[model samples]
Target: MSSPEHKQLIWNLIKDIKVGMLVTKELNDEDGLRARPMSLVQDAYDGTLYFFTSKTDAKAFEIAQDKDVCLTFSNPKDNVYVSLTGKAKLSEKRDLIDQYWNKWVAAWFKNGKDDPDVAILEVKISKGEHWDSTNNKLVQLFEVTKSNIFESSTPNLGESKKFGTE
Candidate 1:
């Protein structure tokens, strides 16, 4: 079980990250992996990540065959990167979909929130790692310079931690 503090840390790392790369195994492709960008549906973290997709989407079919998936979120500017491994399941719950729906989403689904093809992809996170670093450019440059001058193997780049179950 993940501690509440760890959950909060995960949320803090990803709250502003609007998009993540959802990676899944490619069906009938000889152990290949396919990744696609997905917009985050929720602003707050709750151990599960949610995304919107169509029931007919290839990703949905792939998830049905293999639930194991990974989501990666990165922001080079802030030097924050996160990778999460989880099991994915598809849902057609209108109430849940409606909660996350917005005008931007409607652009993709012409039929709006009630679109029959609409589906929600829920990722129950098993484990995740996050790296967060200071965003100041000068601080980053100084860290690099200091590392070189001191012949240090470690640079003051960021903090990285692994959370959730093993």
Candidate 2:
């Protein structure tokens, strides 16, 4: 898909999640992952998810080592959730930080970027898959009820696992 479309899908699914469990690798152990609930930091729909975090955090250290992080946003009420896994880049540009900073973020930015703990986590979309149930429920029912009859009038979006690979 095109870049704008790709970014939109991500923004729509993850934006409402507000707070999500972020899965980042543990620097001490490659096989270990550290998960935390954060008020999902984000930037504009430019195909990259930006998160405001501390550079000294364990999760940050892991990203620095491999840049691969998984961010999950699930709405229990809607039963819809999306998880994004990708490479990350730490940015300290004032403009980028200012664009995303809000009154709530003042506690961290107050000390400024030079603060040993301040940093931005930028995740590059490598591949992402989301379950769009509002559109899928009817189709799912049809498939189950007509398993031996008519089928496949609409393709599943979850089937599209190809993005950023080409």
Q: What is the C-alpha lDDT of each candidate?
A: 0.88, 0.70
Model 2 worst lDDT run, 10 consecutive residues:
153-162
Q: After superposition, how far is residue 19 of candidate 2 from its true place, in Å?
A: 2.2
Query: How many backbone clashes can be found in candidate 2?
Result: 0
Model 2 residue 9 distance off true place after TM-score fit, in angstroms:
2.3
Candidate 2's displacement at residue 68, Å, is 1.3
4-97: candidate 1 lDDT, tens digit per residue: 7888888787878889999999988968999999999887777898989999999999999999999999988788999999999999887889
Question: What CA RMSD would you report for each candidate?
Answer: 1.7, 4.2
Off by over 4 Å in 2: 108-116, 135-166
Task: Per model, state how many residue pairs clash.
Answer: 0, 0
RMSD of 1: 1.7
- Model 2 TM-score on a 0 to 1 scale: 0.74
Question: Which ranges of candidate 1 are over 4 A from the true structure?
Answer: 145-152
Residue-level lDDT of model 2, residues 1-166, one tens digit each, is 3378777877877787777777887887858888898775664567677778887777777777877777777875564767777778788877777777776766766686456667777777777666656545676656566754556444432333335553
